[model samples]
Target: MSQYWELLASRSDDQHTSEELEMTAYRLAVEQVLYYADRHSRTAYWMIERYEREFRQALVPLGIDVQVNRQLRYAYALPKHAKAGTASIAQTVFALVLRAIYDEAASIGQLTEGGEVLCDLVELAEKYRLMSGKELPTKGKLDSLMETMKRWGIAKKSEDHGLDDGEDMAGQPYAVVIRPAIADVLGEAALARLVQFKAVASANDEPEAVTSVAEEGESQE
Candidate 1:
C-alpha cells in the first residue's frame, strides 16, 4: 500500500507520477469530496477515476471508504464512524429539506447538466416549515448555517453558480443551488427519517427524539 502510487506510476508513461497521485490523494483526504463538474476539482476527480482501485486499496487501512457516483460524476471519501461533522439541529433540517427538494428536481429530470438543482429561498422556507414544523432561520442566521452545507460539499451559493454581474445576494431573490453530492450525503434513508420525524412532530414528541434524528442524519462525507 505504501508504494501504491509508485506501482501505478510504473505502469506506463500515461500513468501520472507518484508525486502527482500522492498530492491528489492528500487533497482528496483533506477535501473529502470531488466532482468532475467542479472546475477546481475536475482534474483531481479524473485522477481518482483513473486510479480508483489503487486509491481504494491505499485508503482502506486508513478506514476511508471511497465511493464514486457514476451517474452523478462525483467521488467522495467517508471517514470511519464519522458523519460529515457535528451539525446543529437547524442545519440538519436544512439538509433534509434540500435533499427532498433535490429529489423532487431529479425525479422530474430538472437537474442541471452538472447535477445541481435550483431552490428558491421562498420555497426553501416553505419546505423547511413543512418538514420540521419550524420556521427557517432568518437570512443572517441562514447564511451561517449554510456554510455548514457548503463545507459538507452538498450545496453552493448563487455566486458560486456563475451568476451574471456582481449581483448582491441581498438585492436578489436568494436561492440555494444544491449539488449532486446531496443525493449521496442524504439518501433515501434521510427521506425515511423525515417521515418518521414528521410523525414525531405531529405527535408533539419531546425535543430529544427530533434532536437525536438530526444528529444521526447529519450530512455525510
Candidate 2:
C-alpha cells in the first residue's frame, strides 16, 4: 500500500500529528478540507496553490470532483455526477438571507474590499418576520443553523465571538464573514429567479413556497 493508505488507516488513531499530516501536499489538501473545510481559508488556499495537481489526482479517482479557480483564488469539491441534496426550508431561507446581504454589501464595496459585513441575528429575525409575517426560528434553532452555515463555509463568527444562543441579541451584534463562494454556488440565473420569487412571495404572502422553488432551482444546477 502507498503512504496515503497508511495515513488513511491511521488517521482515526493518534498516530499522526497535524504537522505530520500537513507535510505531504496530498495529505494537506485532504486534511485541510476534511477538517477545517473553508477552501478559501489562508492555509487551504496555500495548500491548493502548492499542490492542486496532486489534490486533483488524489480526489478524482475517489469520485470527488475538484475545481480550482486560480483567478478567484478558491477551490471546491463536488461528488461524481454533481447531484446535490436539497436543503431544508430553514437552510434555504438562511442562504437567501445571506445572498441578499452579500449583494447589498458587494454593491457598496464592503465585501469587495475584504471587509466583512456584520449580520445581527436579531435583525435577521426581524427581517424574516417583516418578509414572511411569521416568527423566525427560535434562538436555539437559528444558532444551530448558523453553525451549519459556518461549517458549509458561507460565514464565520466575528471577532468578538458573541453569545451562542440568545433571544434578545438585537443590541449585541455578531459578525459573519461572508464568502464570495455563495455567488458561485447560487449563480446569477438562480439569483434572478430568487429576485422574482421574493417580489411575488412578498406580494402574495407565500414565503413558505420559496423553499420548493429554491430546491427546484438547485436541482437544475
Candidate 3:
C-alpha cells in the first residue's frame, strides 16, 4: 500500500483524542477519495461510500440526508442531459472538473475570490495528478468550456476597474460563482458521506474525542 494508505490504516488504530483523530481521518479520506476517483474514473458516490464506511457513521443527526445511489447517478448523468447537443466527452470532463473544484471549495468552507476563476481546479488536478493524455486544450476549447459554464449559470465572469490606477484592465481575473443548485444536485448523500467519514475516523482515535478534550483540559487545571 502507498504511504497515504498506510497512514489512513494506522490512523484507525491511533490513540489520539476523538476530535483530532476524526479531523485527520476526514482529511485523509477526502484526499484518498479524490485520488482514487480521479485515477479510476469512479463516481463520487463510490468514493463517498468507500470513505464513509471507514471513517464516520452517518450525518443524518446533523439534519443532512444522504441518498447514495441517487447522488451518484445525478453527479454523473446531469451534465450529459444538460448539454445534449455538445460533445459528450467534453461535457463529461467539464462536469467532473467542476465537481472536483466544488468539492475542494466546499471542504475548505469558502469560495475563491478571483472573479469567475475556479482556482481550485489546478490544485485538485495536481493533488490527484490528473493529466490529459491528449494535448492541452486549445484556446477555442477553453472558451467553449467557459461559455458552457456561464450558460448553465454554474459560473459567471465580471470585470472591475481599479479606482487607484484609474485604468480599465483587459481580461481581469474572472470570478467563478458556484450555484446553490449544486447542493441539490448532489443531494444529501454528500453530507451523509462526510458525516460517516468523520464518525469512523473519530472512533479510531479515542483521545481526540470531543468529550476527552474537555476532560483533559479539566484534569490539567
Candidate 4:
C-alpha cells in the first residue's frame, strides 16, 4: 500500500493541482484503509491509524504535511456511517463486480486508454461470481444499476450494444473508461489494486476450471 501511495504521489507531482493531491490522498486513505480492515476483520480505528501513518509517510517527503490531520479526520469518518448502517448485500455484490472489471482494465492499461470499454455486465457478473450462468438482470434492474454506475462516474453507456441481444451480445461488452474524477480521487495505487485483485481472481478461477476438466476426463475414462 505504501508503494502504491508513493506511485500516486509521484504521478501527482507534475499534473495534479494541490487541492487535487489533497483529495487524492484522502480518498486513497479511506478506500485502502477500509479494504485492509475488511480483509483483516480489524476495527476501523486500527485502519484509520494505519492510513494516517501511511499518508504522513507519503506526504512528508513531498513537503506538504500541513493538512494531514484534516485529511486523516475525513478519511477516518468515511467508514463510520458505513459500518453502523445496514448496507444491501446486493449493492455490495454489484460493487465488487465493478471493482473487478476496473481492475482487469487497469492491469491491461485499458483504464488509461481512451477507447477502452467495460466488459459486458453478464460477463462481469460471472467473473465476480454474481451470476451463476448467462442470466442477466431484468431490463428494469439492468437500467437501474447502469444509471447508478453512471451517476457515480464509474461507468457510462456506449451506443454500441443493446439489452435485446442477450448472451451473444454480451461479448460486445460495455467499455469501462476510467472517470478522471475517480482517477483523480483514487490515485494510481488504489486503482492498481483493482488490477491486482483481477489477476488473483483470474488465477483462482483457472484452477476450478482445470479441476472441472479433469473430472470430466476421469468420467469419460
Candidate 5:
C-alpha cells in the first residue's frame, strides 16, 4: 500500500497550506479505485479526473498500474501482476451478453444519458436461452449471478426504477440497471474477440451434408 503523502512529498514543488487537503483527496481516490475496479461512481470519478495525475503518480511507487480513460471519465488500478479477468466463465459470459444487449439497446436509443440501461429478467432469460440453447437458469441461480454482477460493478437491482427481485416478478417484467462501469470491464477488444469466437463456433456447429449418387461418382473419379 503506497502512502499518498510520500508521493506528494517527492513531487511537491510548493508544499504550502493545501498539502493535507490534497493528501485526503489522493487517499480517497485510491480507495475509490480499490472499491470499484471497473469505474468509480460519478462523484468519485469527478474527483479522480481532477486529481488524475496525483492518482497515477501515487500508484506508481506502490507497484500498481492504473488506467485512466478521460473520454469515458473512469479510472481503475491494476495490481503489479494482475490476472486477465476476475469473473468465472459463466459470469464473464453473462456480463458480455449484457454488454451486447446494452450496445444493441443504445443503438435504438434505449439508454439514458448516464449510459445506464434497464434490462428485464424476461429479456435476459430469452437471451440466455438463445445463447445456451437451453432453458433459463433457476431463480436462485439467476439471483446469485446478479448478486455477483453487482459486486463486480456490472449491474444492480434498481428498485427506484421499478425493478424488483421477488417471485412476484416471475411472470411480469423484472429488470436490472446495467451500470456504465460494464463498458470499462468489457471493452471493445473483448467484445470483438467474443464476436469472432461466436462466428467460428457457429460455423463449426453446422450439420454435415451427405453426398448424392452423382457426387459419389465424381469422388470415385
Candidate 6:
C-alpha cells in the first residue's frame, strides 16, 4: 500500500496530493458513502474512482468492502460482518419508509434525472402510519431524523419550510429527496427487517430489532 501511494503521488497532478488522497480515503472510512453527483462529494468521489484499486486494498484490513456503482455513480463502504444501519426506531422507520417510496417511484420511472425520488412529508406520514400504525413524529423531531438520514447518505431535505404554527399541515412541503445510495445501503432485505421491527414494536418486545440490515458490523452514520 505504501508503494502504491508513492506511485499515485508521483503520477498525481499538483492540484491533488498523496495526503489529500489519504485523507479522502479516511473520509470514506468515516462517511461510508460518496456520490459523484453530490457537490460536496465530487472530489472524494473522483479520488475513489482514480485510485479504485488502492482503496480496495487499503480498506480490506479494516474489514470494509467497497461498492462502486457506476450505474448510480456512487461509492459506498460496507462493513464485512456487522450491523449495517444504526438508526434508532424512529430513524429506522423513516429510512425504511423512504426506501419504500424510492422503490415505488423507481418502478414507475418517477425518479428525478439524477435517479432520486422526491417525496413529500405527507407521503412520508401516510406511509409511516401504514407501516407502523403510529403517528409520525412532528416538528423538530421529524426534522432531526431527516438530518440523520442525510448524514447517512440515504436521503436529504429539499424545499423544506419547517413546521407550521399548527398541526393541520396536509399539503405543506417537508419534502425529502431519497438518494440512490439508499438502494444499495438498504436492499429488499431491509424492508423485510422493517416488517420484523413492526412485529417487535407491536408486541411490546422492547424494540429488539434496532439494527436495520447488517449482522455484526457497525453500520450507523
- The lDDT per prediction is 0.71, 0.52, 0.36, 0.39, 0.55, 0.72
Per-residue CA lDDT of model 4 for 1-221, tens digit only, reads 54554555465454534444455565544332222212222333333344556456564553422122222222321111112122232332344455446656666876432323446555554664532222344567666656655544344455322224445455654533333233222233333333443444421122121111111112222
Residue 188, candidate 2: alpha-carbon lDDT: 49
Per-residue alpha-carbon lDDT of model 5 for 101-214, expressed as tens digits? 777787898876556787777887787555544455578766777887776555767663444567755665457778765665555545444454344343222333322111
User: Any idea what lDDT model 1 has?
Assistant: 0.71
Clashes of each: 0, 0, 25, 7, 0, 6
Ranking 3 against 5 by lDDT, winner: 5
Which of candidates 2 and 6 is the stronger one according to TM-score?
Answer: 6
lDDT of 4: 0.39
Task: Please give the ranking of all candidate structures by TM-score, highest first, separated by commas.
Answer: 6, 1, 5, 2, 4, 3
Quote each prediction's TM-score. Answer: 0.79, 0.59, 0.33, 0.36, 0.60, 0.82
lDDT of 2 by residue, 138-206 (tens): 767767767766655456565333336455344454645565656644544544544543554432223
TM-score of 1: 0.79
* Model 3 stretches with alpha carbons more than 4 Å out: 1-87, 112-136, 158-175, 186-221
Scored against the true structure, residue 16 in model 3 reaches a CA lDDT of 34
- The most accurate candidate by TM-score is 6
Worst 10 residues of 2 by lDDT: 28-37
Q: Which stretches of candidate 6 lie over 4 Å from their true place?
A: 1-4, 13-15, 83-85, 159-173, 202-209, 212-221
Which residue pairs in model 5 clash with each other?
A: none
Q: Model 2, which residues run further than 4 Å from truth?
A: 1-42, 68-74, 84-86, 112-115, 126-135, 159-170, 192-221
Residues 1-221 of candidate 1: C-alpha lDDT, one tens digit per residue:
44877877787375678888888887776676788877888888888887788788788887776778777788877666554435544566677788888988889999887788887777788887787777778877789867778777888777666655334344655578898877665656666656655554543223231332222433332
